[model samples]
Target chain A: MKKLILALSTAAILSVASGAAQAATKVCFLYVGSKTDGGWTQAHDIGRQELENHFGDKVETVFLENVPEGPDAERAIERFARSGCELIFTTSFGFMEPTLKVAKKFPDVKFEHATGYKTEENVTSYNSRFYEGRYIQGKIAGMMSEAGVAGYIGSFPIPEVVQGINSFLLGAQSVNPDFAIKVVWVNSWFDAGKEADAAKALIDQGVDIITQHTDSTGPMQVASERGIKAFGQASDMIEAGPKTQLTAIVDTWGAYYIKRTQALMDGTWTTQSTWDGIVDGILQMAPYTNMPDDVKQAAMDTEAKIVSGELKPFTGPITKQDGTEWLKAGEVADDGTLLGLNFYIKGVDDQLPQ
Target chain B: MTLAEAILLTITTAATPLLLAAIGELVVERSGVLNLGVEGMIVMGAVVAFAAAQLTGSAYLGALFGMAAGCLFSLLFAFLTLTLVANQVATGLALTILGLGLSGMIGESFVGQRGVQLEEIAIPVLSSIPLIGNLLFNQDLIFYISIFSVFGVSWFLFKTRLGLQLRAIGDSHGSAHALGISVIKTRYLAVMFGGACAGLAGAQLSLVYTPQWVENMSAGRGWIALALVVFASWRPLRVLAGAYLFGAVTIGQLHAQALGFGIPSQFLSALPYLATIVVLVIISRNRRLTLMNTPASLGQSFVPDR
Candidate 1:
């Protein structure tokens, strides 16, 4: 009698476990920095939460935050795959090759890579068009800058950052042809102290408005403390700088996350390259504040134009930094040129670090 | 204020944290203990300070809590290395790993939160003096503590009897033990002091430096502080100078980049470490001084034979 009862209980527990597993799709994520870094990784984390909210019991979300790039990333991805994660997301450009390698090892486990080009049969790539917002920020900076010069704190000289610089300059030039910008590269994506120091240096060097491509809100806080105008990135930083933030380019990835998770659960997930923009609800601008009414209206108009396909930020009668003509009048740059963008436009003051 | 004045003010802010941490580590090393967990202690302090300030609505209380947290954290290291006779190097490294992970967990809630900035305390009249006035006389509370700590540490190391006893213990712990000196007790006090200084430095980071709580906000500054002690040849005054030199170079490189100097950003970013070490190395080339200041029994585990 005892043996029969024990066996029956064991069978029941196993059935429940299997039922739970079959009911919920396990989705895992690997991040390059802390989930609360207030920048790139933080943005992804917010999106992850959206996945949980949208799917409820249909999906289970797990994440390994602060996972470094390279070999460790491979181990982390493989660990997730081995643990029966049906879908995995590797966020960061450096995770590209590792994601591919791990995806190959676990073909059954679907993978998504953020901000990369390569996509395998089981791996997909997606990124937001952040430069679209940069163009708006530059226009705002151009209009409001009292000194006619702006300080730009860039994280790295990657094509993404380069595109921001060029697009910003073009937008600023549209407002005031002679408006100039000084660029300072802090190298790392998020070191608050260094980013703050960069902001101070730019201000002391005579730039009235400050903007940063770095992950931390350090620069924004500095601009606030110094009583200067600035913009936020990745996430809304109005809390950090109530009076200082002109407008921020916020990465609102919740909509995309819900869409993807729904598709995954519906058995319609497919590998694709996605570079969504403001129109797709993937990227958005924080409310225009700390600016004149006309400037705010102008910014909104610019946003409308970009979203309506009336203004392409990279279109140009633009000159390279060396005074050589790259694009003739009204020549819109292809995605290929923008992806490989490394050169500075004509009026940028700082040299690009190779 | 002129741009130069602003730059000078920033230099002080940058250097104060390093100076505070290095001076404390110098004492620890002087007492025969090599606590490499300065980074760990500092990060814990930053998170703790930020959290306390957020809770209490007072940055001062947060700073006090931060220092206490660091001191208590070091006691764990002291117990393992001094009492349990664990390898000091291994234990110290472990302490750092533990501190980083623990602080990350503790600071999880504080992440993305803006910290209360420790406002500058301007000295009446003195702050108005040309050039040096704003840089020295007007600054945050931690800056004053950092300067006083340097003077206090230098005077204590050279003039005080207890300081001599501690140095004797560092040089030859067994000999100090034979003389009936409580080597473990002195080392504990020294280690705790070092931890407190590192904590205060961290408080400065979260309160005065960037005024925010992020995981690993120290960003290797503790390791840099550890190096500063060696670069200063364990001299308190030189540590002050070394810290400033590093801070100046770090700020200078940023200015240079803004000026469109065209230097490679990576090389420019590394300029602080290179410049600080080179200057300190050149000044401390006198091997006798460096050798004399270094504790002979540093990093050695002490087992008392009662």
Candidate 2:
């Protein structure tokens, strides 16, 4: 009787384990900022919600926010894996190395990193080509600036921020040749006070328009106070200073997130780098507020051309910071030239920090 | 702002947080207890202050709540270290980890609320005195209170009978106990005082420093305050000087980066921390200095009956 009972218990346990393994999909998200910052993390949270709403009872999602990019991040990732998270998404550039490291430890788990350039068999990368939207904002900024000067509040000296600044300058120069962008490095991602101060200093220097890559609406607040027009950064910040906000580069990660989660549920999850722009609907533009009809029409024309592949934002005749032509007329910029943009355009006032 | 004015303003703002925290830790150490829980207390204070400020739309009330919450949390440490007679250092470290997790968990709701900042309190005649005006008179009320706390504490420690007894407990708990000074009670009071100061420091961070509650907003200021205790050899006035000097390093780094110094911003940030380590190394190398100023019964677990 004892032998029969032991065999029966073992079979029951095995069946239960199999059933658990066959349950609904579990996805985990780790954010570098809070879920309510109305910025990058908030955008991703929206995506997560969209996925959950679409997947309904078939998907299970868990998220940890404000996880710094370091050993702490590694510990969080390991904990998520131990908790049986089958698919994980880490949203930040600094998470690149740690995400890859943890992915190796959990080969069966699929990992996706945002704004990072690392990959493995189970790890893939994705980023929105945000420069495309900045180009459109720059065109409007150039049309409005009386001083022909714009302020660019940058978070860091990374390639991503550099690309945005360069693209904004290029778009401005297309409309106004002598426009100069004054760059101020705040060295922080979400410091509102510093962002506001940087904007004020630029305004003091006769900059009539401001563009910020920092993840806050503080810069726009300062611009509004000073009666200067400004472009919004990540997410719609119209409420911060509706009068001053020109347009925003609305990052639509929800579409991709919903798509990816659906793919994971359907067993079609694959590892590949996905760079989506306006053409693919990942990088979008908010409506132009207080902009003239002609300015709005111009931006719309650029948008249409981009979506239809009739015009490329980074078209040729581009010059390096050292006055050397990187892309001559009628030549398209290659990934190498655009990826390694380490210099200022012709009209930038700030010296590039070494 | 002139160089002198800016330097003065920076010192006061920088010193307020450290000075407040160090004063509290000084009291804790004087009672033969070393509480590494300052970090946790400060973070809690930041979250509590931000929450209160957002609810009431008043920075002052937020600060009060912050201090009260901080003191309440410190009571837990006091109970464990003083009542339970557990190892103070270990308990303190545990309290910090608990406080960090708790603060982060509770601070989730304050991710984007703009805090009400305390306005600068400019004295009628003093604020108009050019360089002196900006330096000494153009600061918020917290700076004034921080400076006064230094002297207030010095008087309490050196002049008052209670202060003498507290020092006696640190110097030789057995004698103090024989003389009828309650070691546990004295240590508890000191620890609570430390908690109050740490709370104020945290309030400064969330209400004034960035005017928003960011996760780990206190950064390592609590640890820095602990180091300032060692750097100052535990004297109240010297603690003040050390706190201001450290603050100078913080401001100097920003100015250095702003001036386009070739050094990376990361290195400049690490400089102040590196300076603290160097100060510790030098003090440690000088054995005489260490033996002269360290509290006799620091980090000691005191059991009255045993």
Candidate 3:
């Protein structure tokens, strides 16, 4: 009787699992921070939601939040792949190697790593052109800054972050030739305390405008408290600094998520390195707020020109830290060079960490 | 404020939390009880403080509630390690792990909400003075409590009879026990004090430090405070200097990076740890200094004799 009962329960479980598997594709995500971190991870989680919304009953989305980026990430990714997840997304740059390692084990499962460089047949690298929005922020900072100086709190000196610093200065320089920006790397992407201190340090040094590449609203709140203008990153931080936030670079990955998940469902999923930009709708700017009408109009004009392919943020008349010309006038920086950007452009008041 | 004054003020702000938590841990360690759960207690304090402040609209009330939560949380550790006669180190570690996980859940809804920051209280004449005035006199309530606690702790540990008894108990609980000091009772109070201080420190993090609750927002600061207790060799005065030094190095590196000093940021980011290693090595080299302040029975569980 006991053996018969056990057999029946096993068959029941197996049937339910198999039935559910056929009904919906299991898409899993690994987050480096909590889904409610109010910054980077939160933005990615929002994108994850788009898959469920767009695919509806065809897709069953699940995520493991606050997965540390190391061997732990490898375990989490492998666990998801083993559990019949057709696709997995590792949403952190540090999870690059881990994702690759796990992808090798699960040859059939597709993997997507955000802001990572390495890729394999099963693994793909995907990120948005966040620097495009930084350009608009710089332009607005140039027009609206009370000190003619802005502060940038960076999170590591990766090519992506360096690109943001360079693009912002370039945009600011376009409007105000004498504009200077200070860069402070908090090292880690999060840690609200360190981010706040970095912002305070810059403000004390006379920067009237503040921006951050780190995943926290700490800098924005600091700017708000100090009565200085600031820009938000990853998500709309108008809630964090309702009046102080001039605008924000909202990372809209939903469209890309929908497209990629749809490809997987359509059986056309090929490993592709995607670096979408403003025109691709992978990222966008939060509404320009707390800035003058002229600055807002100017920012919109720059965004329009970028979308129209008339203005490139990495265009010529730019110089490296050593005063070497990076781009000749009217020369737009190639995607390859920008993707591997390791040097800081001139007017940036911080040394590039190699 | 001038640049120097501003930097100094920032350093003071940075050091206050470390000072408070470390000082509290110092008392607990002095009573021969090692509670590794300082991180856990501090985080709970942070979450509770933020939640209270958000709900009550009073940062002070929030701070009080946070401190109480930290104190209450510490009692869990106290009951297990002190009363249950469980392994102190294991219990302490469990407390921390429990604190981190529990605070994350408690603070889940509070995430993304801007917290009510504890406003600075400027002393009239003192705040008006040049340089040091604004740096020291004009600060948040937490800063005042932290600075005052260091002095109060220093006096309590050295100048008072109960302080000496606590030290005696730390050095030789059995001997103090024979002499009629309630070993368990003293340790209990010491642990509670430690918990309260850690809680207050956490309150500082949410209310005065960053002004919001981030999950694990204590951010290993409680662990730093633990290291600081050892770094100071269990001395109250040294903890002050040590915490401020750590704070100074941390803020100084950021300033250097901001100023584009041509130094690599990875190297700048490691400055505080490097300074800590260097200071610790120097302090350890002085055997007499370490021997004088080291708690003899620290981490050893004591069962009171009937």
**Candidate 3 segments exceeding 4 Å error:** A1-17
Q: iRMS values in order, in angstroms?
A: 1.0, 4.6, 0.8
The TM-score values for the models, in the order shown, are 0.97, 0.84, 0.96
Model 1 spans > 4 angstroms off = A1-9, B276-289
Give the alpha-carbon lDDT of every model. 0.91, 0.81, 0.90
Model 1 chain B: worst 10 consecutive residues (lDDT sum): B275-284
**Clashing pairs in model 2?**
B24-B194
- Predicted candidate 3 versus true structure: per-residue lDDT over B1-306, tens digit per residue: 688887888888889889999999999999999999999999999999999999999999999999999899999999998899999999999999999999999988998888898988999999988778878888898999998999999999999999999999999999999999888888889998899999999999898878888888888898899999999999999999999999999999988888879898898888888888888999999899798889999999898766
Better of 2 and 3 by TM-score: 3
* Per-model DockQ: 0.78, 0.17, 0.84
When summed lDDT is taken over every stretch of 10 residues in candidate 2 chain B, the lowest stretch is B253-262
Instruction: Write down the lDDT that model 1 would get.
Output: 0.91
Q: If you score just chain A, what TM-score does every candidate get?
A: 0.97, 0.93, 0.94
Candidate 3: true contacts recovered, fraction: 0.83
